[model samples]
Target: MAAVTLICRPAGVLPKLSGTCSPVLLAAGPVTVQHRKIHHAVVPKGKGGRSSSSGVAATVFGGTGFLGRYVVNRLGRMGSQVVIPHRCDQYDLMYLRPMGDLGQIIFTEWDARDKESIKRAISHSNVVINLVGREWETSVAKAIVNAIKDPDANGKTYALVGPNRYLLHDLVEYIYALSHRPYLAYPLPRPLYHLIARFFEMNPFEPWTTRDKVDRFHTTDMKYPDLPGLEDLGIIPSSIEQKAIETLRRHRRYRYLDAEIGETKPAKTVSY
Candidate 1:
């Protein structure tokens, strides 16, 4: 009977086997099992806490703004590593350090107009949170933050209007009421409105109240019925009325302590 001997060895060039092999076994060559690369999803470490690692690395643009600070604070408490990009002075960013653990919060200088700086700021992050509220509605900051965590919000643009939409004139009137001031609305002719807008443009330091802004008083931007909104993200839109008194409390003519706060009439809402 012919007996075939097989020498099973690890794949690479390793030292010869210690034991003496039979002539039949020596005839057989070494056999190897190939290795494969394995990938893994990031898993959070330790109990969910500020010091613990949540395994989320996020880059936050405009992290010093009103809405941005709140977003960064929430992200930090969840143990997410946050990268704040800013063009402000180093001193201006000092207060933000305490928002996260010792090494969890990172700050990098970035300019919105500089593409390379923007890329570098977000290069190491797996998530990017932009709090650019220039054209965004600041009242919807809470909704925006919640939307960021929802996977359904991915690749979707959302309109962040409040629960009730009000005309600009009505909003101003509401603010005037909160401040205990009288409001007078005078309709300007189309030609006069354009002339005033031109005059405002010519002012070196244009006043806060501009004609363009005044135009929005009676005008409403057309809403897109096909677009998604705060309601779509499982967030019940918050009414500005709820937060108005507290926000405008200090702006009252009388000091907050001296003033007896009274109920103000709610602004008229326009149904979309």
Candidate 2:
């Protein structure tokens, strides 16, 4: 994993503190500051198309989250019938409802951790996006396995989308063996915490920010033709490169290439 560094600077010079006790001294209280160092990864701009026009029905497992909302919006703009499975019909739906009226977003009650709920969600779509994960308990790999183990009346295609974490690789391989549908992983251009800090204008030097380093993976690297270990976990064959490219192009984020199973590396040696 790679780490992103950030520096913070006071918004203005600290005012000299005045006290009635002894010699005046600078105040040690909290001070307002702004980030000084600026570093960001480049993301390609999406190509213009018939913005509101997708012909496929797509289901999103974790469709009410931050990333899920973004994905749903993008898919809605693309005109795909977007189905989002939610655990509760609470305040979360308030934020998701507007997207639903775009003539594409649909909200349904389903639990990613429950196979029956997953099956019900899949029944209505030909393409599925599994975005479920645990903050601390269950592994994401298990969630994906449970979702794909069974398909609806119309056999569907699935693209597993989530953070480019290690646990997801196992799920990717498992999905490849089970359904042979392409897997999609979104790799943040920089560390996740840094992006969060930039979004919220937080001090990156805070102890909470020092947690974990983040890794970057290109979309082109996610297309594995064969199940690495389940069958033969290795680099995806050259034949699948085009498919990966098309998938990446559709998302307009990054390109997907071949990846070494259990490792994160740019597929420089693999010929496209």
- In model 1, which regions exceed 4 Å deviation? 1-43, 133-139, 182-222, 249-263
Cα lDDT tens digits, model 1, 1-272, are: 00112232211111332222111010113422222221111135668778876655667777888767876787788777788998788999888899888888899988789989977775555456666532334435455445445544444555555556677778888888877777798777866877777777777874655666666656654555566765675667567677777777777775443444456778888876
**Top model by TM-score, which number?**
1
Candidate 2 lDDT at 82 equals 67
**How well does model 1 score by local distance difference test?**
0.60
RMSD of 1: 18.5
- Candidate 2 segments whose C-alpha is farther than 4 A from its true place: 1-53, 100-103, 134-272
Error of 2 at 213 (Å): 13
